[model samples]
Target: MRAIGKRLWMATLAAVLALAAAGCGSPASNGAGQGDANSGEPIVIKFSHVTTPDSPKGQAAEKFKELAEQKTNGRVKVEVFPSGQLYGDKEELEALQAGNVQMIAPSVTKLVGLNPAFQIVDMPFLFNSREAVLKFWDGELGQKLMKSLEPHGILGLAMWENGFKQFTNSKRPLKRPEDFKGLKFRTQAGKVLEAQFKALGAGAATIPFNETYVALQQGTVDGQENTFNNIDTQRYAEVQKYLTVSNHGRLDYVVLVNKSFWEGLPEDIRKALEEALKEATEFERQLAYELDQKSFENLKKAGMEVYELTEEDKEAFRKALEPVYAEFADVIGKEFIDGARALK
Candidate 1:
């Protein structure tokens, strides 16, 4: 009788343990339990940028983050790494291509180095207006340019507006072609921009946007040229004093994802992502120029001197940099540059 009682107790303990295990293994125990109703899961994504959260690019990134999360119904979690917390433009681009970073927001200047066709977007004085740029980018030619990125293991999601590039520095406000003399400015890591700066007789240095603040603060460089949105967003107001309305360069920003990650997404998720990107791009473009104008006004209120260049000055400025086009036409391809110009 004692032996039978002991055997019965052992059997009861085994049964109880089995029941407990089943309960834990079921979807009810955690998110992955079998009975749980969640068909998909939340994936954490790292989105990196080189501007502050207040800039147009930064703000748009924030909007994209919110939209992605909401559209995915909490299935996708996007974490914005604004202000280059993760990496700078070049480093971030490499990381994205390698799948180390899920997404990134880099300017067209950075893309030009990755593919020569991207130089079309960087062509000096090519785009007459934002509408023209949008048309060109959303057109067949733009799609062709985007397709080129696929070979490098990157998927171009959408194009975000970054406004127009202007000149700013601590030394003086640029008012004419002569005003550009000896101005040591920080330029992006693009050949075209560097050529333009050199033509202006300014000693141009390639510095990452993230490090520009500290570099300027330490007197490592005199001043830099970027969009009003970027200048305002990065608080360039704090480090520099003069802002010139040269509007000499275009600021075409791109959002990219890893090709492998993009390809592996389910068809439903992929469609959802495409829709989300389009919505975000449209919203960004509409707000970008408006914010740039606001940033200019805000900079003056912040005690910075602003120079409004005369038409003659603007013409001279344009003339001085004209050689930039011909010089880089070979690398940028004469055919692409001429076609972009002929696009109307």
Candidate 2:
């Protein structure tokens, strides 16, 4: 009887020890173990933007999806949503913050509400060429600007170019600063932009990007400003009779990801995505330049009167709108504005 009791006790002890060993080998044991929990499932990244698939931004999003999957060996899956399919210009930022989406590339102008300093990019004639803008974005000032968003649960990865902004008005040709007076223009939401038109003695209306075409067609606004690619893609030429290559401002986007989501990524996955983005960014800029040239020709063929502003004309417009700098210096930071100007 005593021998049978000893055997039973030993068997019970062995069972308990086996259970403890299994727990030690479980997925919660360490970071690698945690990763094992979803090892079979690829991480999904929903990349959202408000541009057509053929646009520079849209193409780059697709390119990123391809490169990311290839680089991560299917560990990462990027699903791109372009042309506001998921969220429009006004709603994308909110969606990213809420984690309903993992990524978005919104125009810098859209970020003014979050940080007024973002308006530095919207300053008229602040950047003369794409190269100068790239220089600014790759410099110390740009690094500081990107870091400014971390406190808001946002991470700005890179600045992508959409080319320079031009004016398209149905009322008349805009060769002179006075040509913009009394005409209301549709503009992205920002105080600097409002002040831009105001300085020219014009009225500015804040309108959603997707709604810009209808607003122009219905004569709700006399004109709007955007890159040539945007003007061509959105068919703004169909409603507006004149296109001025003012190049007064640039329309660039900040590639953003959710702060928490980005930080939580596995180190290997994060490094691979960064490398992929760097390559995609280079491709997007070259595409932007090509599309700008192509779109300019297309707009002319579309029967819109195209006017290229002379150096003198641009200077005149610049002088007229100079007060905008003084008006927002405090809000955008004098040093910040000065830093951008120094780049030029």
Candidate 2 C-alpha lDDT tens digits along 1-344: 89999999999999999999988866441211123314576788889998889888999999999999999998887889898999998899989888888899998878888888988877997777777788888888887888899888899999998888999999889999998889999998778888999999999999987899999999999999998888998999899999998888888999999898888888999999999999999999999989988999999999999889998998998799889988888998887777776665
RMSD of each: 6.6, 3.6
| Candidate 2 lDDT | 0.87
Q: Can you write out model 1's per-residue Cα lDDT over 167-229, one digit (the tens) per residue?
A: 788887778777778878887777777787788888888887679998888878889878887
| Candidate that scores best on lDDT | 2
* Candidate 2 Cα errors over 4 Å, as ranges: 1-38
Stretches off by above 4 angstroms in model 1 are 1-46, 83-88, 120-122, 169-173, 208-222, 233-241, 303-305, 310-312, 342-344
Indicate the worst ten consecutive residues by lDDT in candidate 2.
28-37
